[model samples]
Target: MSAIIDFTTAGQNFQAYRAEPTGVVRGAVLVIHEIWGLTGHIKDVADRFAAAGYLAVAPDLMGLAGLDATLLAELGADRNDPVKGAAAQPRIREATAPLRSPESAARIRDGVKEVFNHLEATAEGAGRTAVVGYCFGGTYSFALAVDEPRLAGAVPFYGHANFTAKELAGINCPILAFYGEDDTALTDGLPALIVSMQAAGVDFKYTVFSGAGHAFFNDGNTQTYRAEPARIAWTETLEFLEKHVQ
Candidate 1:
């Protein structure tokens, strides 16, 4: 079974959609959503992880303290409507207005830290935690590895590489990153990232699937969805998590 739960961080309450493994647990995976906040597809991803024998939690990373609730709904309604999507982008920006501060960034990181804490408190496989995300969330998963030593592995789909050599040295876990050959915003940065990770002696492996574009894993958006790559990515992600999440 799956449900929404409240978690407090830095005196602010954030929501997460959590799902438990139908069988016993193999481990826990923190699933981060794209810039769209905690959408249905993100929840479905969490469910998929649960179905795969992991305790999955997808947090509402963009659900800031002062967001206008009505705007959130409108932005979500634009998910499939081209015209509405263009019109709703500003609302999406508005929804993230409060999170643009340094203090808010700390709060967001603290919120993620709490997920690891929750797993520890419950005696779940906190020590073997992995992080997976798409798009904006994927970017964060990369950032987390730069400073977080608790991560066992990270699977970031088309996320930008955002670490320096010094920052990469802080990573003690392996990373399995996925990218589309056509995602310039992400792949363009890979050469420098590869150098930094290699210099830091981090175990980093990545694959760029041909003929795929950004957000290829998101089946909800037909325009960018590529089933073949998504399938391969998923299989490799599971294998990587299994190999590392001991």
Candidate 2:
């Protein structure tokens, strides 16, 4: 079953696309969307997790970043078309620029916490929830692991590890992160991040796919999608979640 559900946190009401497992639920997953917001691609990913026997929820976390539902919807629609998506990049960047602000990051972090709290309280109970995210969502996946010790696991794809050793020390779960070797913006910092994670005693493992670029897991974009890498990453992500969350 699937539906749009409403949940509130810190006096803020948020809407999420939720998909329930068809059979017995083994675990639960929070699917964080790319910068495109809660587009159809995100919903489809949630459905895929549901078909895999995990309850999945993709929260629309754009409100705190200055993106309204109407604008996000239009942007999502534009992103579905190659030509339109290419042309809309500037607009998309402008609209989401506020997310880079420290204030917005703090607010979004709370939103993510609330979403996870809702999942634990109403869906999978406790100790059986993991997070999987792409791009922007991937960045938050790492942050959430640090902020929410109750998180079972985190799978971040191509997002920079922005936390320092002190912040990373707060993480209690294992992480399975993926990246494309060509994404220098992230891979260039991998060595330092590894050192920090090791010093923090965090169980962090990562894969950098050769020949793949940033957003390689986003098959919706022909320019960046890498089939073989994405396929392998998906398989590994499921395995990681099974071991940690299930």
Each candidate structure's TM-score, on Cα atoms with residue i matched to residue i, is: 0.90, 0.93
Candidate 2 per-residue lDDT over residues 1-246, each given as its tens digit: 999999676677778999998867878899998877888878998998999889999999988666776786787668767779888778877877899899888888888888898788855647898999999999999999989989999999888678877899999999999999999999999999999999999999999999998989887777788999999998998899889888
Tell me the deviation in Å of residue 138 in model 1: 1.0
Off by over 4 Å in 1: 65-73, 76-79, 89-100
In the order shown, the candidates' Cα RMSDs to the true structure are 2.1, 1.9
Total clashes for model 2? 0
Clashing pairs in 1: none
Scored by lDDT, the top model is 2
Clashes of 1: 0
Cα lDDT tens digits, model 1, 46-151, are 9998998888888886654455544665576685587776777776777767866776666666777787667656655668788998987787788777757888
Best by TM-score: 2
By TM-score, how accurate is candidate 2? 0.93
